[model samples]
Target chain A: MDVDRLNLPSDGDGPVFKEPWEAEAFALALGLHERGLFTWTEWADALAEEIARAQGAGDPDQGDTYYQHWLAALERLVQAKGVVSETELTERRDAWERAAHSTPHGQPVILKP
Target chain B: MSHDNDDHGHDHRSSDNHWSELTLRVKALESLLVEKKLVEPAALDAFIDTYETKIGPRNGARVIARAWSDPAYKARLLTDASAAIAEFGYTGRQGEDMVVLENSAKVHNLVVCTLCSCYPWPVLGLPPVWYKAAPYRARAVREPRAVLAEFGVTLGGDVEVRVWDSTAELRYLVLPERPAGSEDLSETELGLLVTRDAMIGTGLALPVASLSKRGCP
Candidate 1:
């Protein structure tokens, strides 16, 4: 797929994924976009909104927190597009936290049936 | 949440730590999206892999090295960057439109995306954090010489620094001047001297002496 418009943060080699989750978040946004959930313009707008909101909240605007804004934008767009609801997102987040706690150290967190 | 420092002692995991929270949020989002069939996990992996492995500055390095070695290729690159870059099989995404800025004795070119981080992903991959940060974005256009100095690049007063602001439609790549005393180096070897910062116009290509110092042949 031609993701002609999407721009991502990177270093010399490529996109700088400081953490595994950062890459996952970045990819998830692309995945949703590829599925035609929202246009690249919509994604850009949502990301800009998140960045502005963070700045308004006294975020230093340093590069370190970029992906946090990215993740926020992805979540916002997914909800705004009606692909998922706020309640579902919150419930899923809480479920993941519980799973994370019960999981062994360094083991993948798995939601129980 | 206070079930810590008893059994595991020093090994207690800060499950609520900032990164951990982010990790959980991403996991939750991915899980929800997958379950809803809005996004496939394989597609996500493909996107990540494309950026992480397939695309990067190395592609741009080869382009620059080829330009340095072949006059014909250089002409094509400067005249029609997208078409020339396509010859190397690097075309897609942010690279739909491209302009190769040639650095000469009298001129230097630097690229910045003042509005967001629009970059040529096909060649240069994603841009560095500093490129997207507020400081570089504001200062690159205002005080380019000072910005270049911070990146350890110092040009003479005779040189004019031209800053190119990249947009979603057009992206710029700096074709750094080839270093002297390296005419004998093959194109592949020349590519090894090209750096990501050089293509971004933040630094210069490595000289042959430095390569030898680093035990490179």
Candidate 2:
């Protein structure tokens, strides 16, 4: 599945708010970063480097290329550094199947496992 | 803490709160259509259709919030997000082997449909109307910084951006770190800290201690 989200507002360069949902997500990330868990500077640098690599590789997406590189970078960090484990991915997948198959009423179904 | 505008935080506006008084009109239409047989039992298919066609990234935002708030679950999510999200009872025909990319000091995360917009539906619900807007799709992948700037997210030259090329086999979501000083918060409160921008890796979560100092109730 492709992950395409909405345009969220920023503080300095443009609109302060865009879609309500994206705004909420932005608030959470900002909160996490400010506490020194991670720095936006590092995030920006890594993503830029990834984008450059992609460009060198002849990416067709071009300048408008958004987060694809970022996602891959995150994966590299997680796997390389063990931020999160691969086994976790498998366990969660099994749990999700249990939850998805059991929930009712077209709402989110919390998994029991 | 106070918002830039000095306003204290507001409580979450639950889905229930959004129903308009004119909702009766909507109900009336639904009944009218049903009675008129404009749609049949086969019409339930429309829920999936409408979700696929009309709903936007807000749905994805909701899913991200849930994941950020629940660590054990989030752990499961990052590992096999598609299945974990499916446990919540939302499944999009378009969603599959989903991977959640988390924020870290060395890496930043963002997602784009390199070929076309192939978004995860079950977890994100639906792609926002603008996501498919050619201008946005073209502009987002082209000048991410410039585009992100329009979103009010400014990254200095020191920051690095990594864009992912989404394929039919892989789907991605940005799993931003949880905010600090909120170690005591409930799942709901933690969820309040999540934002759509974080999921797309354009922004960060809000801090709770700072929020507390600002008279957050």
Candidate 3:
């Protein structure tokens, strides 16, 4: 099937990644879809909802933090899907913050027990 | 001990604000997904790796190569990029209604999404963070030459720049003019010279000599 509706912005440039983390975020969404955790349509709907919600909250929708909203939608759906609880998600987020702060320079910040 | 590494030394305070915060949230979400067995970290890594190197830019490179080497194909790509791209089975979500913009000696094309980071995933994959940032989005349309200069792209004074605003209905891709002395190069070799930035108008395609020096596959 031809997806004639997928209109993304580009100057015919190859997939240029500005940062490492953005790639990770893109992969996460694709990975989740590959694992059958969600369909692209579902993901699209969720992402659209999140964007709408952000706009309603006066996000300005200037194209920055688009992935932030993407991650937010992923979190909401994963939580709703029973993959994780809201409390657990927050705890883990805090843990990463701590890990990032504690880890040395030029090293990966992995969570530890 | 201060958690201030030389690498992440810039903006320690604001660092915790945008990218870092989103990163932590994503990491947390990944952990939760993994814990629930809904997703595997390995699968995630593989997926990212695939897009990072294997399947993304190269696909676009092939398309660009074809257009460069074949005038008829080039005409088709400029006329109907979506249909032309589908010939190679590169049609999918976020790639519908692709409009190929041709760069020439007189006109240069740049693209941006003012509303969101709607990128052509089928051929280009995910967009760079800067492309999705407010600074680039805001400045690209207002002062394209300045933004391009920041990216080290300085157009000739004689060349006019056209900025395409991407919406949900139309996506823009740039088909850069073939570099000089590339006439003898094969399609594969031409593809090698075509970089993501070249297509995005931030940089020119690599010269044939540098193409081999770069050790691209």
Candidate 4:
């Protein structure tokens, strides 16, 4: 993975994935890119647009919310490329929330069919 | 995890709930993407592992320590940072274009990414939260003296302060002056004196006296 082309918020080590979920979001984007869903330039452009939009919405431009913007950009890109629909994403998210509530603390939240 | 939660029962639930939504969202996205055959679970694990276990400030500390003990290496570091750093096998990503700012008794170098958190990842690892926060980004260039003071780095009036702004194209690392009385220390021992904040120019390298007090032989 030529992560250099991503233009992600990073320090000396590489990309900064502060949490497990942040890393997952980053990998998802990379995975999609690897599968030819989008080019690195297109991904960069989408992330840039998301950051600009968030700034416009008074997001304070704090670094902690960086991954949130990354996630949003991924979502936007996947939908735009017809890889996944917004409706499916929304539905999946809701299902996850329901699964999480029903699952006990420390238990894995498995979405049941 | 269970033991710590038992000790701090009140704080546990909030921490769990805080990241729950974001965690679930990512899980949801991953599941959806995987179901669509767009992403693989193993690939995600590999990416996560790379960032989590590998790369950090220890790499930069080694570089700084070598420079301190070897003048020739220090010259190469200042002349061509990227190549010199590559010698340590720390080349990739944000560290492609590197600049080593040498700090001296006469001049102090501080680094910041005013636009965003662009750093030399091959060396330093992740930037601290404050380094990426709004206040440090805005004030690092405006009144670096005050910022340094806040970080407990009080510079004399005679010392010149230089602020280096890191970008996506170019990143800067401060080669902090070796503390006095460290002449006898080995290169590896000297590495222990190098702190992440020192390389970032927010603090100085640990003094030799402090090392001895910490019981280092």
Candidate 5:
């Protein structure tokens, strides 16, 4: 099937971002592709699997979740590649949350030293 | 780096819900990528920094200033925004099918993507959190006046408020009406007066005096 037929917002010309995180996610995905970490075909299949999973789990199927699925696929691919274990990923996430919560509003959130 | 899962138990608290889950997912992926040498932390910071500070509403400000200074350019901008904006090399993924909305004395324009968070990235770097949240999306279409008021924008009753719902295929950028006493200002000066919210139609460009007071050169 043609990827364009997927009709995802990110597929064509449209607003690039609705939030900073979204842009970060977009850049991360593009960066990964550039580094040869995953082929576009692999990326697409992973993303498709994620969206399919979400749909099966009752995701409304709106474009609102397009990026969420993208992020999930990224995580799955990286884990599958053995670049990082799920345990390490979770620990880093908790660390970030602690750091972010401690940071003041309007200030850039940084990981604590 | 090998992950020792036996010692560390999963923290269900961090991945239990929506926002938290998303944040953790992004953070985890970032750290993993960095550890694998697939991406540099500094490089990612630089990329995010470019969008956050270096390249942003300022680019759109220049476009608005040029349109204000040149009538023909304004016409071109309204007729075919993509080509006109590409004249300055602001063409990309989110800006391919660009539609320029001119804020007039009689008609005020506001943009939102009710279905999702679609926004012009070439000119405007990213959508603010409020623009992406459920409240703003639902209210912007249902109660634009209230939403605009929350943003400190009060349109006169006589001025028609036209809210444009951005979609995946097309995006809208508002060309805010030039402020009074800005006629004598240079194009570059006019650009300085334009704000990010002005192009989004949520706020107007600052006055020349205010711009000067804000230390804008």
Candidate 6:
């Protein structure tokens, strides 16, 4: 699925969804990362661990749905990793929203190109 | 050694101008957060992560694809859109009232969140980065024809592009006319041409191809 044109930067070249799994997996990792529950390293390890566990559990979907794994990985990484508290994360979100949408330059739309 | 590659020659003047004009308030708030140390850089990084990666095109694609296949459903979609979308299990907190407008020989529909970029969230998922900003919200209604031109879509006098303002309470979807020579395609196959932008009324569904060229994006 193409990203909505309205959602893109005014100067973005084009929307690209070259691979289907990319977006779902990205969203899962992002949701966990937003809460600050895992470091980049931990996020990687959690995904690998989830893959192993899914394989062991005889998951038929296999590698197709890393998003599912991503969600599961986040659920565990949050409690086990102890990177950030829920309340702390909420506070951060509130602050980010303040910063991200506060004014005309709050969030950088051209972050990706 | 310090090394940096500034490969892109994007107009910083324009980007900066746009950024300053639209995100000044957001930047101010971010500065305040930095002052207080409430949001860690890591947390902020993750926020962007979900924003771009997790909440993505699949959500919007599903809506556009569905509308292409079902006309009676599309009719209901325009009549009481939010309720009709519920049939496909697209209802949720994010999805508010959504209206699906069908484009035909006589009428064409385009949607913009003119007042503040409020959109049909449930069916489309999270709004895109551009949609929520100031320029698109303001210019889309005032100069829709010009804006469409920016996207390389032109309408003739035979067709009328009616611009609809999407709100939190009422949102709109454009049911693009089904392409020619696609009568034999499956539901999923036909869905491919239903681009996310088309559903949001920025463009038309990609025209279909003959049998040999089926499955082309």
Docking class of 6: incorrect
> What local lDDT score does residue B209 receive in model 1, on the 0 to 100 scale?
79
Q: Output the number of the DockQ-best candidate.
A: 1
Give the lDDT of residue B91 in candidate 6: 61
Clashing pairs in 1: none
Candidate number with greatest TM-score: 1
Candidate 4 local lDDT, B1-217, one digit each (tens): 5684465655444224333778877887899889988888998888667656776899999999999988999999999999999999988542248999999999999999776566787898767667766567778899999888777799999999999987666789999989998999999889988988899998999888767776754
Supply DockQ values for each candidate: 0.32, 0.03, 0.24, 0.26, 0.15, 0.05
Fnat values, candidates in order: 0.46, 0.02, 0.39, 0.42, 0.25, 0.06
Question: Which 10 consecutive positions of candidate 6 chain B have the poorest summed lDDT?
Answer: B14-23
lDDT of 4 by residue, A1-113 (tens): 11222123232334466678888897787678778888655776677678778888998766678788889999889889888888888888888887766666777668898
Residue B86 in model 5: shift from native, Å?
1.3
Q: Is candidate 1 or candidate 3 better by TM-score?
A: 1
lDDT of 2 by residue, B1-217 (tens): 5458533564332322232222222222223333444334244444434543454455555666677666688788878877777776655443257888877665666677643455665555444444433445566677777766665667667667777756655778887767767777776666656666667676677677545664666
TM-score of 5: 0.62
- Can you write out model 3's per-residue Cα lDDT over B1-217, one digit (the tens) per residue? 5765675656564324333677777788777677777677788787677666766666788999999999999999988899999999888643248988999999999888765666676777767656665566667788888777766678999999999987656777888888898999999889988877777676668777887687767
- Which of candidates 3 and 4 reaches a greater TM-score? 4
Model 4: fraction of the reference interface contacts it also forms? 0.42
Report residue B11 deviation for candidate 4 (angstroms). Answer: 22
Where model 3 places Cα greater than 4 Å from the true spot, the runs are A1-25, A31-69, A76-113, B1-46, B93-95, B207-217
Query: Best lDDT goes to which candidate?
Result: 1
Which structure is stronger by lDDT: 3 or 6? 3
TM-score of chain B of 1: 0.87
For every candidate structure, what is the RMSD over all alpha carbons to the true structure, in angstroms?
6.0, 20.8, 9.0, 8.2, 11.2, 17.1
Each model's backbone clash number = 0, 65, 9, 7, 1, 22
Candidate 1 per-residue C-alpha lDDT over A25-79 given as tens digits, one digit per residue, 9 for 90 to 100: 9898777777778766677667767877887899766667888999998888887
| Candidate 2 local lDDT, A19-67, one digit each (tens) | 3223222222233234343454454445455655776687744223343
| Ranking of predictions according to DockQ | 1, 4, 3, 5, 6, 2
Off by over 4 Å in 4: A1-19, A26-56, A60-63, A77-83, A102-107, B1-19, B36-38
Query: Which candidate, 1 or 6, has the higher lDDT?
Result: 1
